[model samples]
Structure formats: structure tokens, C-alpha cells
Target: MSSAPSIPSAPSTHPAPPAGWQATFSEAVRLQSENRWEQALTLLLPLAEQMPHEASVQNLTAVLLAQHGRLAEAVVLWQRLLAADPGNVALVANLGRACWMLERKQQALEYFSLAVQLQPQDPLALLNMGAIHQGEGRFEEALAWYERVFAVDPHHVQALFNSAQLHADAGRFTRAHELYRRVLAIDSKHVIAQAQLIFTQHYLEHPSPAQLSALARRLGAQCAAQSPVFSNWLVSFEPERPLRIGLLSADLHDHPVGYFIEGLLAHSAGKEVTWIAYANNEKRTALTERIAPAFSAWNEVFRWSDDQLAARIRSDRIDILLDLSGMGSGHRLGVLARRPAPVQVNWLGYFGTTGLPGVQAVIADPRCVPEPEEHWFSERVWRLPSTRYCFTPPKNAPEVAELPALRQGALTFGCFQTLAKINPRVIAAWARIAQRAPQARWRIRCGVKSSEEDRRSLAQRLVQAGIAADRFKVEAPLERQRYLASYGEIDVALDTFPYPGGTTSAEALWMGVPTLTLSTPGMLGRQGEQIMGAAGMAENWICFDEDAYVDRAVALAQRSAWLALAEQRRAMREQVAGSALFDNARFSRDWHELVRNIWRDACEQVISRSSQGISGPKP
Candidate 1:
């Protein structure tokens, strides 16, 4: 979304217009001030044509046109106005914004550059420039622009939020958390910041599950207050009719969530279910093409408003709606909050509870959400027969290579998790293991190649943890194929605690490399433990504490232990390949049964309530 502010409406700032036209222009401006934009536009259009050379009339008309989504027309009008007064910063900024809305990136940047030169203190111009740089993956450049914005206005919420997001993305969660806190202090109801704060808590020191749940619940309640829940769905409770299951998510492409759901979508359901996909993003990948056919119907709901999407689901008579995105990226929790379907379940995309009252349950296996930890979630813990996750390996993945330890003369321990999860404690544990097993090599994928600052910071932290600086190296992130193939270079993959590697751990196992996991409290922590159990790896590889984790990792890197792991890693991959993790047919049966039974159980409850003259409560 374009962040450019509208042209300021200060009449005194402009030159006096011709005598007879003053009242008419004043009336138009008055209408705009009164929020009657349509009336304002109507009054300005004829005046704009009659007084073709009038800067005030033309600029006003262009602003109106831009507000009405006529970006091309607005751009032309602004261009003409700029030719008349080339140094007008407002005109320059407005033109830049119109070009941006039209997706003319280069033109927008040029005009924005002039706007900044004309008025270096303009907040809107700086913000837009930051957004463009951030979009292009120039993180440092984007941060520089945001820093300029902060210098001008420390309370600038957008700049603060954007910078926080970049920090979070680069795995500097502590800094991200600081910025998010500042934004919330300025504006308590900032939705994105609230969600981001919830997401960031885990990456820091151990965050209590209850505290996170409470925060998520607040967000859920906030969304629920937007629109009233609907409860008048009239449908036949037939046990045999095909259940209409609607899936809402933005990650329908080749992402971590996409990989997790691939097998479930591919599993044939025959007539037992009708799958409808609500892809919340426009950019689709080859993985998108692969999953499209599996759905009975597909709708690109990216442009759909919450009410519009909820109405569509209600109109479609969807029996069950699964929220795949939860509070993660591209989540439309508002639609779910409106209770668009009879039953709503939180699924694979997010590991934790959604904390949404609209969502009835969270899909998990017994191992993922063990009986004792069931209270951690706001939603009911609906346990699957085995593992809740099923995998579909990437088509481009190479065959598992022989373990590098045999030929490389020493074992190498690696962790390719996102920088955000490698907290201070994780760094300390890894340092301990590195120090104990001095002959073993360490490669920690901190983030992108440009994340030099983060790598340097991590390196400093490792040294602080008592490990020799020369014994370890912080590596740059790898491309997908290379990242997967690079796994064979290591004897063992070390999982990060609290927010352990989910997709990374799975991929390492697929590449015939085993991961040693340490259990921690929250939902995200359980993923590593669960994935290891699902893959039928050695249970001894999972440690209960940091001390155990360090001990187990060092023990695995010993000469004899490393020698034996060459064959164990290959066998581990075979185990994962043969396990329920990739069994699409078995996963399909279990998933469908779960969905079917959940709806049937819901329908029966509604019927029983109706018979007893009691009202069924909204989820």
C-alpha cells in the first residue's frame, strides 16, 4: 500500500486565485473539509476544465481522482501541475504517490527523490522510500530511510513498525521486540504490532505459554469486535452428503506451510469432502499450480474484504473452515472471527493456539500437544492418529549424499534455522558443544549474505560464551536446493530451542542428516521433538535441558560416534521417507476422518440442543 500523504489543504499557502473564482474554489475546498469528497470532486471537475491553467483547480481534481482510485488520471493531472510549478513539493509527492499506485516504480522513486530534495524533512516521502527499498530486499538501505524518519519524528509509528519487521526478519528479535513495544506505547491498538509482539516473544528468552495465549486472545477478541458473529445457517444434517471444507491462507505457494499441507491436498477424498481454497495472495508459484487441481473450487480472495469473504463462505454453505495462517503471515482472522462457518479449526500453518474464540480446535498429534500441555492452547486440542504433519519432498531435492565426516576427517555440526530463533541461550549451548568437541567444525547459517551485522553479532556472542573465535564461522543463508544438499556436509544438525526448526529440521532429515533436539515449553518447541519421533530417529537424540543438549551434541561428535553416524544418517532419511510423514494416503484418511467427525459431532450437538430447547453457543 502507498504511504504518501494527500496534498495539504492550506489555502493560505497558495497564491491568490482570480477574483471571481475564489468563492467557487473555497466552496469546493469546504466540501472536501466536510468529508463530502464526491461533492468536492463534482464541483472541481467542471472548474478544472474551464480553468485549464488554474493550479489550484487542477491539483484539487487530481487529488480527488487519486482518492477515487483513478491513478492514471491523477498522474497525468499531477504531471501537468508539476510542469507549471516544478518546485512544488506537494505536487511532486502527490505525483510520486500516483505513479506508485500505478506500479510505476522507477517514476515513483524519481519523483520521491525530488520531493525529498525539495523538503528533506517530509515524513511521507521518507516512509514510501523505505517501503520500496524493503520490498526490493535492500534491508540496510530501507533501515537508513527509516532512521531518517525517526530523526524527524521519533513517534512515527509506521517507520517504527517497518524497522521492527526488518529486525524480526533478520533474526534480531530482541531489537524487534523493543521497536514493537515503542509502537504499542504510541498506539496501543496497532493490530500488526500486537500480532508481531506475540510472534516475537518466543524468539527471545523463554516466554510463558500462558502469557502468549493471553496476548493472542486479546487480538482474537479485537478481531471479533469488528463484526457480529453469524448464526443463522440453515442446512441439512445429512451424514453422507459431501462436507464443504473451506481453507483460508496466503501461503498456498512453495513455502514452509505449503510443504506441510501438500500431501493432505494431494490425497484424494473422492466425494467425502468438497475442498475450496481461498488463496489470500496474488503471487503464485509452481507449488500453487500443483495444488490448484486438488481443490474442488479455488478463489483468489486477496482483494476480498473480511465481510465480503465471510459472506462468500456463508453463501457457499461451508460446513467447516480451516484457518491455515492463524496469526502468521497473511492471516484473515477477521473473517474467521465473524463465524462464517459452522465449525472452524486451526491447522498446520501455525504451531500454537490461535487464541480465537471463533476457532473451535487446533489440529495436533498426541506427541505435539501432549496431555499435560493441552492447557497451553485456547482452542480444544484435537489429536490426530499419528503425526499431524505430512510431507511432500521438493521435486528438485538431490539424492542424499554420503556423510562428509568420513572423508572430511572431522565431524561438522550445523544449524540452518532463521536468525530469529538463535537466542543467547541457544548460542551458549552451541558454544559449549563446540568447546567440548574442539575437533568438530561449526557452521551457523545466521541469515542472508547481507546480514553481516547479525553474523558479526552472533560471532561476538559465541566468543563471549567461551568458545574460541577461530573454531566457528557464522555462514550465509543458502538457496533451497543448495540448502538441502548442503545438509550432507554435516554429521548432525542442531535444533534451536524454544522456537526449534520445523521445516529446517524436516529438510535435514530428508537429506539424510539427523538433528539433535532439546525440548522446551511452548507449542513451537514441540515441533522438533515431534518430528524426530515421527521420523523414528533415536530418542536419545532429544534432550530435556540445555546441559543435556550440550552433552548429547558433544557426545555425537566424538570420533567413534561420528564414524557410526555415516550409516545412521542414511537410515534416518529412509525412516522418515517410509514413515507417516510422507504417507499421503494414510494422512488423507486420518485428516478427512477428523474433519468429517468434527462436523458431524458439531451437527449432532446442535440437533441435541434444538431438541432440548437450548441454544447452541457460538464457538
Candidate 2:
């Protein structure tokens, strides 16, 4: 939906109008302020028709029309009003915002430029201009506007948030953290700020696990206090019957979560579980269309308020709610805080603890989150037998070509993880690996499309680490087919340490390349270990420390025939296709048993509490 145009800052300076026009305008303005849209339109429509040349009447009518999704009509009205008074800063900004929302990018920029020229100090004009630049992927230019806004209004939350987001995207975590803290200091309850603050911590060089857990707990408490409670609804649990499982995620369509979830959904096709998926994705895709038929019920609840979503879950009487998005995008932590479902589980889409007390457990394997490290999580750990995820590669992937490094004399060690994962320490480790492995050139794909600045920064880091600039290539992102095929060029894949790649590792394994990972104590750092274990490649590849990590990569490269066989790709496919990583049926059975056990335990707790005449969260 299009937002209503902002009210013009400059009032009309025309001579005194005819009879009672001022009273009608005042009543109209009062109605609009109260959000009585129809009544406001009723009052303003005739006035606009009577005085077509009046700037206020035209601007007000355009705003009302824009609010109702009449963008074309509103744009025309704005143009007419601007012709009369082109100096109105708010009017120009509103016009620019509407055009931007309508996807008229160039026109929006022109209007925003005019607005900024008219009133350089206007925060709205600066913000709107920044948004236009950001939309076009000119982040540096966008930062200039946000900085200007901050200079004028130190407490402007939006300006701070946008600037922080840009910094985070560019992998400047420290600056992002500082700005996020500033936002929280101004408005502690800001949802995005709270969530992103927790997210940026993992990027720090030596993030404290205790500090992360504490932050989660604090955010959970805030959410619990703010959202409505559903303590009375716990009595709705029924243990004797089959469970109605509700899976929640925004990435239920063509994402890593979606690929892993397909196997479970397919394998559980005849199970007794009643599947209900609450999708938080704003727009539907072809992938969503394909996956929709598998679920007993699918709800597109992206627009639903937290209270409304919680009420819906309660009304559905869902026995167990599994959230795939732990701290990532499209998460409804507030809804989970209400405890609408009897049992809540945190699964994929995040690495660290959710810090939510309402979440009862997290699904994992012993390799991912060892017993000693369980204190890092707020939820109980439910370990699976082999792997936490059963990955299904895209059906359209091209046939894996012969390893390019094998045919050529030199080895190509590649990693397709994001720029954020490739920190200075990781680069130094890769440099050591390069020194040990003779004629091995590093090729790192910045998983997303990158700017020249991003590529240059990464290249500079590699150069500073005593590696020749020409020895490594920092390539921009590739299209999907080409991305999968590029793995063919690599002899071995090197995983990022501390915060390793999850889906990228899986994809590398699927494309017939072996990924070497360094496993740390934290759960966020051990996903590659679990993923490699699932593929039956962890025995020699998972490293304990930096030396071992470098040694493993050197070992893989030094061993001839490691990437030689033309049939190597086919053989790797057979191994993975039959292994636990891609075994859908096995994963489905494990998931079913786990859900039943958790549900049974929850029901038993409810029964015991009732008999003892006590009521609280399920034990």
C-alpha cells in the first residue's frame, strides 16, 4: 500500500479566500488527522472541485487519494500543486516518495534533488533522497544523506537505523553496533534495532557467548512484557491424539531452509502429523506455489500483527510450533513470547541461541552443538542421530564438470561464502594455506552481487596477509547455474572459521567439492562440521585450530588424484545421494519421532500440573 503524502510545510500565502472556505478546510484537516478517511474525502472532494487552483486543497486531495492507492491521480495532483508552489519542501518530498514507491526511479531522484535544494536542512528530504540512492545500490552516496540527517537531528531513529544497516551490509560490524546502540538508547523498544544488534555480534573478532546469551534473555523479557500472554491456552494441549505441527518461517520459498524442508515434507507425506505452515514472506513465488500443496494448511501472514498471529495459532490449537527463523528476517519473536502453542522449537535459519524463554528446544545434532556448549542456548537441545538438515539441491543444477584445477597444473581453492564471513583472521588462515599448497591460487566468490569497493577491500586484506594480490581473485557473484558450475573450477573448498557458511558448504558438497572447516566450541562455529559429517567427509577435513585448518587444505591439494577423475563428480553424487545428508525418508522418520516425544512430554507436564492444582509453563 502507498503511504499518504506528507503535509506541506509551507502554508498558503494567498489573499483572504471567499466565505466559509477556511472552516471547511479546517474540518477536512481535522478529519484527516483523526484518520477518518472517507469523511475527510467527503469534505475535501467538493472543495477541490470548487477551487482547483488552491494549493492546500490540491495537496490534501492528492494525499488522500494516494493513501487509497490512487497513485497516478495523486501524482497528477502533486504536479499541479507543485506548479503553483514549487518551493514547498514537504510537497516535493512526498511526490518523490510516491514516485519511488511506484518504481519511477529517475523521476523520484529529480524530485528529491529539487526538494533538497529547496530545503537542505529538511530531514524528510534528505532521507527520501538517501532512500532513492540506496535503492539503486549507491550505498556510499546514501550514507552521505543519512550522515547529514544525523548532524541535524541527533536522535533521528530512522536515519541511524538506515546508516547502521548499510554499515552492517558492508561488514563494518563495530560501526553498525555503535549506531544500533544509539538507536536503542533513543527508543529501546525498536524491533529491528534490537534484532540486528544481536545479529552483528557474531561478526566481532572475539564475541562473548555469555554476552550473546544475556542479550537474548533481555530481548526476550522485553518482548514478553510487551506482547499479550496466553497462559490459559496451555490447557488446550491434548496428548493422546496425533499432533498438529505448525512450521513458521519467512524463507519457506526457494531458500536454504526451503531446500532442507522439502525432504522432510516429502518424507512425512503419509505421516499422522497435520502440517500447517505460517509463511511470513511478503510476496508469493513459483517456489511457494510448488510447496503450498504439501501442507495441510498454509497461511500467508506477513501482514498480520503479532497479536493477531498469536490468536490465530491459539485458535488453530497447534500442538507444537517450530520456528525456522531464529533471529533472522521474518521472525515473530513477539508472537512466540505469547506462548500460543504448547511447545515451541527453534530450528534452521539461525546459528546462535534465540534467547527467548518461550522457546522450549532447538533441533540439532551432537556435532553442531556439543553437550559442553549447551549453556549458550536458552532452549533445551534435542540432538538428532546424524544431521539437523536433509538438503535437497535444486533440480535444475547443471552436471558437474571435471575439476578445472586437476586438468590445469595449479590448484584452485574456492569459498563462495559472503564477504561478512571472510574476516581478517580467515584471510590470514587462507594465506597460510596458500603458502603450504604449491601453486594454489585462491578464488573467493562474494556470495551476493558486490560493489567494486567491496571487492577492493577484500583484495587489500589478502595483500596485507603476505599473499600476492594476483594469487587470489575476488570475483563478483554469479547466476545460479553458473554459480553451481563454478564449483567445478575448485579442487577443494575452504570454509570460514568462527562463523562458517551453512548453505554454501552444503552447495559445495552437492557440486562434488570437499569443504575443509575449522570447528570451534560455539554452535555458530560448528555447522560446517555437522554438514561435512553428513556428507561423510568430516573425518579428515574438520580442523580443531588454525594450524590444522591450513594443514588440511595443504594435505588435500598435495594428494594427486584428489580431483583428477572425470568420474569423481559422478561418484561424489552417488555417495551424497545415498548418504544421510540427502536421505529424505530417514530424516522424516527422525523428525516425526522427535515431534511426538516432545508433544507427549508437554502433555504429561500439563496433566501433572492439573492433578497438582498448579499452572505455569510446561516443564
Candidate 3:
């Protein structure tokens, strides 16, 4: 993402201070050390006026203000300090941090560069610089900066975590695994790192399905032991009554999760369920605005602590709480572990096991998780009958255009997933596909607009594999409507392996562009395959290996009746629009039944335990 638009500079406007500044400054420092930020700021504000020209005083005051969310004021003070002490590394670095907090990324990068130049070994400077490059889609540069930080401080957790993420993003699973191991060795209790290590295994050829189940059982046992259990009397699920349901997630805005959920919400409204949304995103978008009213109640709990959120859930007396975000950041796994509701399940927003004992099930579809694979989860594998997702196509999508190859004389194969999913192996596979269809051009649309550097780098890699530079096209990120329209430019969509496109595939199909996906043994790689299969296009698009993939693409490109098939795709939309894949009402009703059954089963267990004279500890 680019830097945010510039904001007007904050003016220096502090009044002159009283005397005896030294004693007050010391008191402020003491309060700051004690973590009493408001009290510290009260002392430091007045002291700043007495010593406006002193760098130390101004730095400390600015730090306090920044810590207290007074970013504009802190930026003013930090800039004033930097103007006087241009060579001071701390002042320069702090100014950069304040600017970054204000989303003034251009200014932040400049100051951070100055700080790094002043002290090459500074870890904070290195980390911030790496972050800036990473945000700009400059992966190699980000990796170099992270490596430098690792060299300076080998045990730097953020550096290790971020480096591992980059590797994972680039489809270097083995290297990513090694880095995550290093992180776990240093801090075993780091929950995100632990979760990531397990998640990344899905990309490997032989992901041990049992590993997630074992991790779940172990984590669940720990949660059960340390946290007080609710007495049977405290938990209730009335099978014949309207259930109070709570959904928790950070992706309830304009995202894939939102599209998948909109249908369910519309179907569930005023039904036998009273749904509440505990949203973790602070910002709202057009989609969020559209979906917000579907919930009977909406709570913006982005600022609430896990404990606070959990207590709120219990207070609401929610019968069931479905975690839309499983191991994702901002997840309230802590709250789930505390057992705020009688039933909790992991759904939509995440794949794989959450490893939380309080979570009773992971919702899936019969096609995605076979009955034999049920043992892969710690929670019960509850399969929805048709498909897990009920896709809602974007409202502003342009009408499907005729096959581009009909006019252009050569077929164009493309994918619009994030560039991170395009690893060396994926690139090599695409090279082979292009080799098979010599006349076909390759198109890639990344999440970020492709820079010239990105195009050059990609061209270098493809040319090395015998693909011509002129045969490749890299489109920049576009607005939603135009992006959907851009799909009309390609004859076929190529799915990324191990981390294949989920929403992108849906959009492609909606635009009458069939996606060719290479299915792996693991769940992550099978999403596109499942979506296409549910849409009844498995034979036309799903492949089992590189040869099959190349064969499919080449066959499609060479067909004399290619345009007939392409024109027939216009009907493909009509086929899926009301089918199981796009039927929200059916999916919603199925989900409702699934949840009710789980809750009733839990209630039955509790009743059975009570009859057997069993009692658990009370919270």
C-alpha cells in the first residue's frame, strides 16, 4: 500500500511553564517508568514549557504524548526536536515512528533512513525500514533488512516471525518451517508462532493431519486445567427456542469473509436465531455498512481486552459463539478458552484446527473434508452438505465479455491473487504451461499494483525458464468494478498451489472465467478445486499434477471450438448463481441446523453427566 495522503502539520502551541522543572521532570520519568502514562503526561506537559529548547525534555514529553494517543501533538514536538538536533538518532527515529503512527509513510521512511544511517546496527530502525519495504511489495529488500536485524540481535522474535512469514508468502515452506522452529525454540509460548508453524505444514507434500488434532487436544487440556469450568447448571441450550448466537471476527468488513457471510446473515435474520456480531475491525467500509444491519446487535469490540470481550459474551448469555477468525490476529482465543458460551465452533475466516479445547467443532463441507479425514481436527468435523461458502458476487461487476482470444488471436491465461502466493515452483509450473501453449500470453494481477521493479524481476525469472518477456502481462491493482471487468481479458484463470485463490476463484467463475487449479492432498490447496467442483466444472478445470495442468491449458488453447466453450461460459454464471455454491438461504438453514444439533448434543452430554452424579468445578 502507498503512503496515506499528507495531513496538515500540527502547530507548536504549548504555553510557558512554571519554575522548578528538574524535580517535575524526574517525577514524570518515574511515573512513565511506572506505566502511569496519564499522570506522567500531566507532569511532563508543564516541564516541556520550562525546557522547550532541551532535547531530552522534549523527547520525553513527546514519547509520553505518543504513548497516550496524542499522535499529532507528539509529531509537532518530535519535528521541533529534530529541527534543532538534526544529528540526534533518537530524535530522528522517534519522529519517524510518530509519522508512521500518523500514516505519513513517506516522511516516516525518510526519518527512519536517517536513523539507520546514523546507527547501522540499530534494531528498531532496521525493523521499521523492513516494514516499509514489505508494505511496498519489495520482499527481497524487506528480507535483507530483516536479516540485518537478525545479525544484530539473533533472538529478535518479530524479525524471525516476519522473516518466516515472507518465506511462507513466497511458497518457501521448508525455509519458513525452519524459521518458525527457531522462533518456537526461543519462545515456545508464543501462540501466533506456534499456530503458524502448524498452519504452514499444509503447504508441504506430507502435512501430518494428526499434528493439528494433537495440538488441539494438548491446548484444550491446558485451558481446561487452568481455567475454572462452568457448572452444568450455568450452561444452557434450549433446543425448541430461539438460540442467541454470537459471531466473532476481524474480517466482517469488505472481505471474502464478508461476502461469504452476507448471505447467511440475510437468511438468518428474524429466524429462529438472534444473531449478534462481535466485530474486531475498527474501520467500516461500504460492505460493512451493508451487512451491519443484518445482525440483531453489533458490538465493535476492537478495543476490548480478551477478558472484557469474554465477560461481555457471558453477559449476553449467548447460546453459541462461532469464531470466524480462528488463529488469526485479534482472535479472542483467550475468551473461547474461558468458555463464555455453551457451544463454540470455528468457521469461515480460517482453515485448519484452532487447537482451542473450548471450540467444539470446525465447520467444513463434505467435499473439503472427507469422513476419513475427520480425525484431523481436535474439534468434531461438522460438514455442511453442499459447499462451505455461499458466494455473493460483487454488485458492480460488468457484464461478461466475449472470449478475448477470439479477437486477440492468442489465448491469455491469468491469475489475480497476491504476488506472495507465486513461489519459484509455481513460476516454473507456469513456465511449463506457457511452453506447452507457445502462443498463449501469461497475465498476472497482484493485490498491489505491480511496479516496474516487480515486472523486471518477474520477466527475469520467466525468461530464464524460456518464456518471452513480451508474452507476459502484469496488471496493477484496480478498483473493484474494473478489477472484476479485467477478468474478461483472460480466457482461463490459473490457481496458485498450496495457497490457492479462494475468493479470486469465485470472482473468476462469476465473471465466466474458469480457473484451472492443481489439487494437493492438503485442505489449503484444495479450496479452488472444491469451489469449482461444487460449481460442476471439476473435469474442465481441476488437475492432479503439473502435466495434467499443462495439458488442460494447452487443450483449451488449441481447441477449434474454444470460442463456443467461452461463449457457453456466459451460462456458467446462470448455473452457479442459484446453485448450492451461491444459495445463501440453503447454506444458512444448514448452518443453523448444524449449530442447533451441536448445542443440543452438548446439552445432552451435560444432562447425562448430571444423571451420572458428575460435577465440575465452577468459575
Q: In model 3, what lDDT does residue 265 have?
A: 84
Assess the local accuracy of residue 438 in candidate 3 as a C-alpha lDDT between 0 and 100. Answer: 84
The C-alpha TM-scores of every prediction are 0.85, 0.85, 0.80
- Model 2: per-residue Cα lDDT over 377-440, one tens digit each: 8898888889888887767876766777656777788989888888888988887877777578
- Local distance difference test values of all predictions, in order: 0.80, 0.81, 0.78
lDDT (Cα, tens digit) per residue for candidate 3, span 1-619: 3432233343366555557777888888998876676788887787787777776788888888887668889988877776665667787777787787677778888878887887899998898889878766687999999999989999898899889887776656789989988998998766667667766665555456577667756655655565654443344545567888899999888788988888888788556888899998666788899988877799987655555677778888888888987766556666777788878889888777777667887888876787777776777888788787788877978888888888888888898987656767778888887887888888888775355566566668778887888998776788889889998889888898867888899999889888899886545657877898878787768888878887877888775758676776778788878777787887888878887787777777777777788785221
- Which runs of model 2 end up more than 4 angstroms from their true locations? 1-118, 559-570, 615-619
Clashes of 1: 1
The superposed Cα distance between candidate 3 and the true structure at residue 289, in angstroms, equals 2.4
Model 1 lowest lDDT segment of ten:
4-13
Error of 1 at 532 (Å): 0.6
Per-residue lDDT of candidate 1, residues 123-231 (tens digit): 9879878987887678889999999999999999999999999988877777889999999999987777888888777777678888888889888888777667897
